[model samples]
Target: MRRDIFTDEHEAFRDMVRQFIAREVTPYHEQWERDGVVSRDVWRAAGRAGLLGIDIDEKYGGGGNPDYRYYAVMNEEFARAGATGPMFNVHNDMIGRYLDRLCTPEQRERWLPGYCSGDLIAAIAMTEPGAGSDLQGIRTTATRTGDHYVLNGQKTFISNGQLADIVIVVARTDPAQGHKGISLLVVERDMPGFARGRNLDKIGLHAQDTSELFFTDVRVPGANLLGAEGGGFVALMQNLPRERVTIGVFALAVADKAFEDTLAYVKQRQAFGQPIGSFQHSKFLLAELATELAVARAFTDKAIAAHCDDELSVQEASMVKWWDTELCNRVTDRCVQLHGGYGYMREYPVARAWADSRVQSIFGGTTEIQKEIIGRSLGL
Candidate 1:
C-alpha cells in the first residue's frame, strides 16, 4: 500500500514535522491536557519550524508552497501520533484559506505576518449557539455604522476560541435576505465588548481548548471585513469542501493507527495459552480492518489530489468525510474491544482514542448532513 500522492520532498517535510512534534509537542501534551489548553510556545515553535503556513505567501514569512500535500502529511502525522491538541488543521486548512484567498491586500499586510509567524492565532466563527450546520438559521448580526459594523452574537463550541487573536466573525448584514445576508468580519482581540466565556470541559481532546464567544456591539472596522459584503455564505460554501476533506484525511490516519495498535495488542496478549491474534476471530477481524482502511485510504488520497487540483466536488468531499469518519469510529471501537479490559482504562491510548474519535462523525458537518449533500447531488 504505497501512496503516490506525495513526493520525496513531502516525505522529508513529514520527517521534520514528526521530529518537531517529538521535541515540542509530546513532552508537554499531558500538561496541556491538564491545563485544558496548549501553550502558545508550541505555536511559536511551529512557526519557527516552518509548520504553520506552508501555503501562505513567502514574503509574509510562509513556506510559499501552494501544495496541499504538506498539510495532508502533517495531518497524518498528528493523527498517527494521537496529537489532537493543536488546532493546526482549523488554522491552516480552514481559516487560512479565508485569509489567504479572500482577504484584501491591506488585510493580508495587517494579518499575514502574525498569521504565518504564529504570533496571531486565528479562528473562524460559524457555528452559533442555535445554528449548527444551518447557516440560514444564524442570528448573529453586524450592522454598519459610520465607519464600523456593530457585531452582536454568541458562538459556541469554537476551536481555539480562548487563544485566538483574530476571529473571522460570520454575521448577517442584511437581515431580510436569510443566507444571502451573511458576511465575515474580522474581530481582533481587545475589541470593546468582545468577550470569551470559560474554556469548556469536554469528554475528550482535553488538550484542545474550546470556548464560547460573545460579541456585544463589538465595533469592527470596515477594513476588517473579509470578502465582499453579503458574500460570506458563498465563501463558506467554496471553502468547506477543503475542511471536509481534511476531516476525512484525519479519519483515515486515525483508523490506520488504531488498526496497527490493535494488531500489536492482539499478537502480544495471550488467550488460552496462546496469542489472541492466533485465534481465527482476531485474525479475521484484523484482516478485515486492514482491508477496510486500505480501501478508504485509496479514496481519500484521490480526494486530496482532486482538492489540490481545485476539482474536488462538494458531494465527493461529503462522501469521503462521512465514510472515513464513520470508519474511524467503527475501527477504533473494535480496537478497544480487542484490547479486552485494558482498553477500558484511561491509561491506554486506545481508550483515549475511542473518546477522541467520537466527535469526528459529528463535526465539520455531521454524517447526516454529508449524506444529505450526497443524496441531493444524486438528484434524490
Candidate 2:
C-alpha cells in the first residue's frame, strides 16, 4: 500500500535520519548491545541532526515542527535499521508530549534546552514493583514540606534509567484522593537521596538500559512539579494514546521489515528441487503475511492520521497497540520458522527480531491490559 502520510519534506527528513543511523548508530550497535547501553554521543548526534525534539519550539533548539509524521518517519527508519538501542520513541513521543504540553515556562527554560541538545536524557517512572498497568495502585508518595516535596519511592523497568538526567517521577501527593493524588515531579540526578539501583538484565533489547530507581526522602522543589500539583494521572492518561500509537507504529515498521527480509530469504534459499518459496505451502504463507502486513499498515497509518488530528480515542489506540504488536510478534515468529535453522542463529536478523518483538506485546501496556481498556470502552 502506498502511504500518503508523508510529503517531500518528510522524505528529506527520513534521508537525514537514515544517514544519521548509518553513521552514528549502525556501526556501534553491536558494541552497545555488549555494553548494555547506547553511547551518549549518539544522543548528541541525534540532537544535532534535529531528530530529538521535532515538535519543541525552535527557540529551545528544536525543529519546531508540529507535524507528528516526522516522528513516525523516524520511528519507521529506526525499526527498519534494527536500531533498538536508542530510546528515541521514549524521548520524542512519550516524555516529549508531557514536556511540550505540561511544562511551565520556568520548567521549560530549565529543561528544554538540554533536552533538545540531548545533554539531558529523560525517562518517566510510572511502573513500580507493585504496579505496572494499574496506576492507582502506585504506593510511591511525596510528602509536602516547606519549599519542597519529600519523595520516597522505587521504580523498576524504567527505560533510560541509567542515562536519565531528568526523570519524571510519578508519586502520590495526596493519598486520600486516590488517582487524583498522583503528581509528576522532575527528579534530577544530582539531587540528594536520588539513586539508581541496578541496570536490569533483560532477555532482549540488550543495548537499551532498563533499571531500577529509588528516591529516599529526596527533596524535589515545588517548582519541579510538572503540571498541576495533583494532576499527574490526568496528564499520563492524556499522553497514553500517543504512547500507544508510537508503539504500534514501531511494531508495524518492524513487522514490515521482518516480512520483507523473510520474503527475500524464502525466494533465494532452496529446498528439495527448487526455492522454498516455490513450494505451495511457503507461497501461501507468504501471501497471508503480505496481506496481513498490508492491512496492518493501512490501519496503522489511519490511526496515525487520526492521532495527529487528536481524533483518536483511547479505545482505538488500545486496539491498534495490541493488534499491531501481537501481529508483529506472530509475523516475526513465522518469519523465523520460515528460515528453519538459520532463523535460530544469532547472526540472522530474524533471530534478533524474534527476540526483540517479544516485549512489544508486554510493554507500553500489556496485551491483556489493552484488551481490558477496549472492553471497558465498549461497555462490556
Candidate 3:
C-alpha cells in the first residue's frame, strides 16, 4: 500500500539520500566491515550533503528542519541500501537530540558546527558493565571539583565509541541520591585520562564501531555539563521514546526490504522444476509475511507521525520498538529459511540481514524490557 504520511519534499529528500548512499556508502562498505569501522571521510561527505543534523539550527550549520519525516526517510533509505556502516542514525537521531535539547549557547557554538559538518563525531555513553537497561544501577562516578567534574567510570557497548570526537558521558554526580544523582558531561577527545578500548567484535554490524570507554579522573570543565547537573535520568527518559522510534524505523525498513528481496527469489528459484513460490506452503508463508509487514508498516508510520507531532507516548514507542524489531528478526529468519542452504552463506544479503536484525530487538531496549514498560503503563 502507498504511504501518505510523506509529502513531495520528503520523497525528494529520499531520492537525494539514495543517491548519497550509492555514491558514498555502497562501494566502501565491504572494506569497512573488514576494518571494523567506516572511513571518517564518508562522515564528512554526509555532513557536506546536509544529512548530519537535520533539526539543528541553520545558524549552527544544520538544515534547520525539525520535521522528523526527513530523518525517517533517511533511515528507511539507509536500511533499504543495507548500508549500516556510518552509524548516521546514531549521530543524527540519538546524539543530535541530546545536543539540540541540552546544549548551552556556548556549548552549541563549540560543538554544533563541527557536529553538523561531521568534522566532529559524537557518541553517548550510558550503558556500563554493571548496568544495561537499569539506569539506577550505574556506578560511574563524577565528583565536582573547584572548576570541573572528575569522572571515573567505564562504559561498554557505546556506539560511535571508536570514532567519536566528543562523548556525552553519563556519570553519578551524587551517588547518595540514586537515579537522581546522575549527570551528563561532554568528554572531549584530548581530555586527560580518557581512553578507548578495542573495537569489540559483534555478531553483526561489523562496519559500525562499538567499544568500551574508560574515564579515570577525567576532568570535564563545568561548562561541558548538559542541562541540570542531576538531570541525566530525566533527559534520557524524555529522549528515549524518540530513540526507540528511530530503531523501529530501521527495523521495519529492513524487514520490508527482506520481504521484497525474498519475494523475487522464491518466484525465480525452481524446486522440482517449478518455482518454489508456486508451492502451497511457500505461497502461504509469503502471504502471511506480506500481511504482517503491511500491518507493521501502517503502525510504524503512525508512530512516526505521532513523534513528529510530539504526541508519541512512552508506551506507544515501546510497543512499536519491540513489535517491529521482533518482526524484523522473524522476517529475516524466514527469508533465510526460504533461501535454503544458500541463505547460510555470508555473501547473501538475507544472511547478513538476518545477523544484523538480531541486534535490533536487543539494543534500544530489549524486547522484554519494552514489554515491561508497556505493562507498567497499563498499571499492571
Candidate 4:
C-alpha cells in the first residue's frame, strides 16, 4: 500500500535515521544486549544526529518539527533495524510530550536543553510494584513539608531507570483524595535518599534497561512540581493518547519488518523440492500476513495524521494501541514458526523479534486494559 502520510521531507529524515542506526546502533546492539543496557555514547550520538527531541523547540537544540510523521518515520526505521536498545521513542514521544506541554517556562529552561542534547536521560515513574495498569492503586506518597514535598515510594519496570538523570515521579499527595490527589514531581538524580535498585532482567528487550527505583524521604523542591499540584492524573490523562498512538506506530512498524523478513525467509528456505514459499499453505499464509499488514498500516497512518491534528480521541488511540500491538505479536510469532528450528535460535533476528514483540501487547496498557478503556468510552 502506498502511504501518503509522509512528504518528501519526512522521507529524507527517514534516510538519515536509517544511516544513523546503521552506523551507531546496529554494530553495538549485541554488546548492549549482553551489557543489559545501551552505551551513553550512543545517546550522545543520537543527540548529535538531532533524533532525541523532534517536537521540542529548535532553540533548545531540537528539530522543532511538531509533525508526528517524523516520529513515525524514526520508529519505523528503528524497528526495521531491530534496534531496541535505545529508548528514543519513549524519550521522544512519551516523556517529551509531558515536558513539552506541561513544563513551566522555568522548568523548560532548566531541563529542555539537556533533554534535547541527550545529556539528561528521563523516565516517568508511573508503574509501581503494586500498580501496573491501575493508577488508583499507586502507593507512592509525596507529603508537603514547608517548601518541599517529601517523596517516598518504589517503582519497578521503569524503562531507562538506571540511566535516568531526571525522573518524573507520580505520587499521592492526599491519600483521601484518591485519583484527584495524584501529583507529579520532578526528582533529580543524587537527591538525598533517591536511589536506583538492581537493573531488572526481563524476558526480552535485553538491551533496554528496566530497573527498580526507590525514593526514601527524598525532599523535592516545590519548584520541581510539574503542572498544578494534585493535577497529576489530569496531566497523565492528557498525554496518554499520544503515548498510545506512538506505541501503535511502533507496533505497525515491527509487524511490517517481521512480515518483510518472513517473506524473504520463505523464498530462500527450501522444503521438499523447492522454496517453502512455493507450497500452497506457505503462500496463503504470506498472502494473509501481507494483506493484514497493509490494513494495519492504513489505520495507523490515519491515526498518526489525526493525532498530529489533535483530533484523535482517547478511544481511537486505545483501539490503535491494542489492535496493532496484538497484531504485531501474532505476526512475529507466525514468522518465527515459518523459520522452523532456525527461528528459535537466538542468532536469527526473527527470534529476538519474537521475544521483543511479546511485551508490546503487555505495555503501554495491556490489550485487556485498552479494551476496557474503549468499552467505557462506549458507555458500557
Candidate 5:
C-alpha cells in the first residue's frame, strides 16, 4: 500500500536518516550490545545531524521543525536496520517534550543547548522499585528545605540511564495529596549521594542501557523543578500519548521489515525440490500476513497523522499502541515459525527481531494497561 502521510521533504529526510544509520549505527551495534551501552559519540553525531531535537527551537541547536513525521521517518529507518542502540527516540520523543513545554526561560537557556547538541543526555525517572504503571503508588519523596529539595528515591529500568547527564526525577512533594503530590525535579550527574546501579541485562535491546538509579540525601535546587510543583502526574499524562504513539510506530516498522524479509526468504529457500513459497501453505500465510500488515499500516498511519495534528486522544493512542504492538508480536512470531530452524539461530535477523518484539507489549504502558484505559474510556 502507498503511504500518503508524508511529503517529498519527509522522504528526503528518510534518505538522510538511512545514510546516517548505515554510517553510524550499524557498524558499532554489535560492540555496543556487548558493552551494554552505545558510545556517546553516536549521540553527538545525531545532534550534529539535527536528529536529537527535531521539534526544538533552532536557536537552541534543534531542527526547529514541529512536524512529527520527521521523527516517524527516522524511527522507521532505525527499525528496518535493526539498530536499537542509539535510543534517540527516548531523547527526542520521550524527554524532549517535558523540557520544551515546562522549562522556564532560565532553565531552557541552561539545558536546551546541551540537550540539542547531545552534550547533555536526559532521562526521566518515573518507574520506581515499587511502581511500574501506577503513578499514584510511587514512594520517592522530595522535601523542601531552604533553596533546595531533598530528593531520595530509587528508579529501575531507566533507559539511557548510564549516559544521561540529567535525570528528571519524579518525587512526592506532599504525602497527603496522593498522586497530586508528585513533582518532577532535575537530578544532574555527579551530585553527591546520587548514584547509578549496574547496567541491567535484558532479554532484548542489548545495546540500550537500562539501569537502576539511586538518590539519597541529594539536594536538588528549586531552580531545577520542571513544571509547577505537584503537577508531575498531569504532565506525564499529557506527554505519554506521544511516547505510546512512538512505540506503535516502532512496532509497525519492525513488523513491516520482518514480513518483507520473511517473504524473500520463503521465495529463495527450497523444500521438496521446489521454492518453499510455491507451497499453498506458505503462499497463503504470506498473503494473510501481507493483508494484515497493509491494514495495520493504514490505521497506524492514520494515528500518526492525528498525532501530527495534535488531535490524538488518549484512547486512540492506547488503541494504536496495543493493537500495533500485539500485531508486531504476532507477525514476528509467525515470521520466525516460517523461517523454521533458521529462525532460532541468534545470527539471523529474524531471531533478534523476535527477541526485540517481546518488550514492546511490555513497556510504554503494557498492553493490558492500554486496554484498561480504552475500556474505561468506553464507560466500562
Candidate 6:
C-alpha cells in the first residue's frame, strides 16, 4: 500500500535516518547486546546528524522542526532496521516534551543544549518497584526543604537508567491530594546519594539499558522542578498520547518489515519440490496477513496525522495503541509460524522482532489498559 503521509522532505529525512542507523546502530548492535547497553558515542553521532532533536528549537542545538512526521519517519526507519536498542523514542517523544514545553527559561538554558547534543542522556522514572501503569500507586516521595526536595524512592525498569545524566522523576509532593499532589523533579547525575542498581537482565532488547535507580536523601534543587509543583500528573497525561502513537507507528512499521521478510522467505524456501507459498494454506494465510497490515496502516497513518495536529484525543490514542500493537503481535506470530523452525532461531531478524514486539503491547500501557480507557470514555 502506498502511504500518502510522507512528502519529499519526509522521504529525504527517512533516507538520512536509514543511513544513520546503518552507520551508527547496525554495526555495534551485536556488541551492545552482549554488553547489555549501547554506547553513548552513537547518541552523540545521532545528535550531530540532526536525528536527536527534531522538534527542539534550533537555538538550543535542536532541529527546531516541531512537525511530528519527522519523528514518525525516524521510528519507522528504526523499526525497519531492527535497531531497537536505542531509546530515542522515549527520549525524543516523551521526556523532550516536558523539557521543551514546560521548562522555565533558566531550566531550558541549563538542559536543552546538552539534551539536544546528546551530552545529557535523559530518562523519565515513572515506573517504580510497585507501580506499573497505575500512576496513583507510586511510593516515591519528595519532601520540600528550604532549597531542595529530599527525594527517597526506588525506580525499577528504567530505560537509560544507567546512562541518564538527567532523570525526570515522578514523585508525590503533597500526598494528601492524591494525583494532584504529584510533581516532576529533575534528578541529575552524581547528586549526592543518587545511585543506580545493576543493569537488569531482560529477555530481549538486550542492548537497551534497563535498571533500578535509588534515591536516598537525594537533594534535588528547587530550580529542578519541571513544571508547577503539583502539575506532574497533568504533564504526563498531555504527552502520553504522543508516546502511545509512537508505539503504534513503530508496531505497524515492524509488522510491515516482518511481512516483507517472510513473504520473500516463503517464495524461496522449497518444501516438497515447490515453494511453500505455492500451497493453498500458505497463500490464504499470507493474503489474510497482507490485508490486515493494510487495514492497520490506514488507521495508524490517520492517527499520526491527528497527533501532528494536536487533535488526537485520549480515547483515540488508546484505540490506536491497543489495536495496532495487538495486530503487530498477531502478525509477527503468524509470520513466525510460516517460517516453521527457522523462525525460532535467534539469528533470524524475525526471531528478534518477535521478542522485541512482545513488550510493545505490554508497555506504553497494556492493551487491557487501553481498552479500559476507551471503554470509560464511552460511558461504560
TM-score for all models, in order of appearance: 0.99, 0.99, 0.99, 0.99, 0.99, 0.99
TM match of model 5 to true structure: 0.99
- Clashes in model 4: which pairs? none
Model 2 spans with C-alpha error above 4 angstroms: none
Query: What residue pairs clash in candidate 5, if any at all?
Result: none
Model 5 misplacement above 4 A: none
- Expressed as tens digits, the lDDT of each residue in 203-254 for candidate 5 is 9999999999999999999999999999999999999999999999999999
Task: Report the Cα lDDT for candidate 1.
Answer: 0.93
Cα displacement (angstroms), candidate 6, residue 301, comes to 0.4
Q: How accurate is candidate 2 locally (lDDT)?
A: 0.94
* lDDT-better candidate, 3 vs 5: 3
Model 6, stretches more than 4 Å misplaced? none
Greater-lDDT candidate between 3 and 6: 3
- What are the per-residue Cα lDDT tens digits for candidate 2 across 221-262? 999999998999999999999999999999889999999999
- Which runs of model 1 end up more than 4 angstroms from their true locations? none
Alpha-carbon lDDT of model 4: 0.92
Cand. 5 Cα-lDDT: 0.93
Best candidate, lDDT-wise? 3
- Over 1-380, each residue of candidate 1 has an lDDT whose tens digit, in order, gives 99999999999999998998899998999999999999999999999988888899999999999999999999999998889999999999999999998988899899999999899999989888899988788999999999899999999999999999999999999999888889999999999999999999999999999999999999999999999999999999999999999999998898899888889899889989999999999999888998999999999999999999999999999999999999999999999999999998878888888998889999899999999999999999
| Clashing residue pairs, backbone N/CA/C < 3 A, model 3 | none
lDDT score of model 3? 0.94
